[model samples]
Target chain A: MERDDIIEYSLHAHHSAEEGVKIRKKIYFVTALLSIITIVEVVVGVFISRSANEFANPGLWTSIKIGYIALTLIKAGYIVLVFMHLGEERKHFKWMILAPYIMFLLYLIFIALYEAVAVGHGMTL
Target chain B: MSGEASKTIESKVLWGGKVSPFSISYGKMMMWIFLVSDALTFGGLLVALGFARHAAVTAGEFWPSSEQVFTHFPFTHAHLPLLYVAFMTFILIISSVTMVLAVEAGHRMDKKKVAFWLALTVVGGLIFLGSQVWEWSTFIAGPDGDITTWADNATLKQNFFLPTGEMVDGAAKLGQEGPHAYAMFFFFITGFHGFHVFTGVLFNFIILMNVLGGTYEKRGHYEMVEKVGLYWHFIDLVWVFVFTFYYLV
Candidate 1:
C-alpha cells in the first residue's frame, strides 16, 4: 500500500546530538525548578500556618494565598513552555494558546479579590 | 528544497491555502485547543470552591483548612502537614519529565528510548492513582468510633484530630455544622484529577504498545507519542494548580 497521508515534519528528524543534550538539560532544569517551588511552598505554608496561625487570624490568609498562587502559576508556565514545548512554537501561536488562559486568570484574580473584600463586609457576591 | 520553498511561502501568505497558520499539525493543534477548554473547566470548579469557602468562612461555619486535616502518611503516626500531598506533587512532576523525555526521543526518531521513557511514565501514573485511592479511603473511612450516641458521628469525627493538636467545642458541634463544602470539594476536584490520571495511564499504555510493535518505526514518525506527551504534561500542569488551591493555600 503506497499510502502518502503522513505529511508530518521531517519524519526521521534525527536532530543533532547537541540539540538532544540541550533539550534534556532544559527538562532537568524545569523539573528542578518545579520541585524547589513545591517544597518552598509547603514549607512556607506550614510554617506560616503554625506561626501566624491563619486559623486565628484569617486576614493573613489572603496574602498567603496570593503568594502560593503566584508560585504555582510559575511552575505551570514552565511545564507548558518547556515540557509541552509550547515555547518552541511560533510566535503568534504561543499567544493564541496563552491569551485565553491569561484572560481567565485575570477574571479569577478579580473574583478572588472581590470575595476577600466582600467577605469582610459580610456580603456574598 | 522544500525548506527554501516554504520560507518564501511563509513570508507571502501564512493563512492562504495549504500552509498551516499555526505551523502545527491538525492533531497537535486540536490537542492544545482541547487542553485550553479543559483548563477553563477546572478554573470554573475552583471558582465554585472559592465561592463556597467564602460563604462558609463568613458564616463562621467550619471550613477545614489544609493544615488542619490531611496529615496521614502511608505509614507512621507523625502529624505531618502537607507532606503526603507534596509527595504526590513530586510524583506527578517526575512523570511529566519522563513524558517530555519520551517526546524528545520521538523527535530524534529513537524508538527504544521512547518506549523506555513511556514505560516509566505509565508506572508513575499508576503510583499516583494508587496514592489517590489510599487518600480517598482514609477520607471516607472517617475517624474510628463506636457510633452509639450519634448517627453521623463517624463521618463527623473525621474532624477528630487536626494538626492544630486541639479539638474545639469539646466533642460537639466543632465550630458549627462541620466542614461540608471542604470535604465535598476535596472529593470532587481530586476525584476528577484521579480519573484523568487513570485515563492517561490507559492512553499511554496503548501508545506504548504501538511503540513496542514498531508501528511508529514503520510510519517513519512518532507524532502520536508527541500528542500523548502534550496530554500528559497538561495533566501535570492541572495538578500544580490543584495542589496549590487544595493543599498549599
Candidate 2:
C-alpha cells in the first residue's frame, strides 16, 4: 500500500502521489470539521441538560435547539458534498439532487418545532 | 466520469438527449438516484417521528431528556449523558471518512489501500450495528423493567431526571399522561435506521470480498466500490438526522 504499484486501467482515473496527498488532506480537513461540530453539539447539549432553567429561557433554548439542527445539517452537508462526491458533480445536477432535500429539511424543521411549541402552549392540533 | 471540462450544448438539440447530461457514469448516476430516493424515505421516517413526537406533546409528554435515557456506557454507571451516542456518532463519521478513502484508493486502482480502507469500513459498520443493538437493549430494559412493560401502566415510574436534577416518574415527567408514544417512535425510527446500517455493513462486506477477489480488477473499473461508498455515506447522512430528532433534540 505504501507504493502505488497497483494497475490502474480506467480512463481518466488514478491520481499522482501528490494528488493523492492533496485529496487525503481535504478528507482530513472535512473529518476535523465534522468532529468539531459534533463535539460542540454534545457539549452544549449536555450543558443544557445540566444547567439551570434550560426551558425557563424559551428564546435561548429555542436558539440552542435550532443550533443543534444547524450543526446537524452542516454534518449532513459534509457527508454529502465530500464523502459522497456530490460536490464533484455538475452545478445544475447538484442542485437537482439537493433541492428536494433542502425543502425537506425546511419543512421538517418548521413543522416539528411549530407543532411542538403549539402543543406545549396547550393547542389541540 | 471523464474530463471535467464543460462544453457548451447546442440550443437547437437541447431537449433531444444527453441521457447522461451530467456526464456521470451510468453506474454512479444510478447510485445517486437510488441514494436520493433512499434519502427521501429516511427523511419521511424522520418526519414521521417528528409528527409522532408532536402527537406525544399533544398528550402532554414529548420525551425525557435523551442524555438521561441514554446514559449507560457499557462498563460503569457513572451517569454520563450523551457520551455513548456521541461516541457512536464519532465512529460513524470516521467510518464515513474511511469509505471516502476507499473510493479514492479504488480510483487509483491501489488494491491494497482499497482493501485496507474497506476492511476498516466494514469493521466500523459492524461496531456501529453492535452498538445499536446494545442501545436498543438498554432502551428496552429501561430503568425499571422493559420499557414495553411500563407502557401498560397508567402511571409509570423510572429514574427520569429533569435538568434541575429532580427525580420523577419518567413517563409522567415525559408525557404527563397517556400511552408511551416515545417508546413506539424510538423503536420504529431507530429500528429503521438500524436496518439501513445492517444492509450497509452487508453491502460493504460483499464489496470487500469483490475487492479481495479482484473482480473489479479484471473489470477494468472500481465503480462498484464507488456505488457502495455512496450508500455507506448515505447511512452516515441519515444517522445525522436520526441523531438530531431521536436523540439530540
Please tell me which predicted candidate would have the highest DockQ against the true structure.
Answer: 1
Model 2 C-alpha lDDT per residue in residues B132-233, reported as the tens digit of each score: 887776665653335576554211224345545453333444434323666677778788888988999999999999999999888766878888999899
What TM-score fits each model? Answer: 0.85, 0.82
Q: Which runs in model 1 stand beyond 4 Å of their true positions? A: A1-14, A50-52, A55-62, A108-125, B1-17, B143-157, B160-177
lDDT of 1 at B124: 99
> What is the per-residue lDDT of model 2 for residues A54-123, given as tens digits with 9 covering 90 to 100?
4567678778888888898789888888888889777877998889777976787688767766665574
Tell me the lDDT of model 2 at A45: 75
What TM-score does the predicted chain A of each candidate obtain versus native chain A? 0.72, 0.70
Which candidate wins on lDDT? 1
Q: List each candidate's DockQ score.
A: 0.47, 0.33
Count of clashing residue pairs in every prediction: 0, 2
Docking class of 2: acceptable
TM of chain B, each: 0.85, 0.81
- Which digits, one per residue and each the tens of the lDDT, describe model 1 over residues A1-125? 86444444432235766899998998888889999998899888777763235656667777777888789879988998888888988788899999988898778867875775477357533
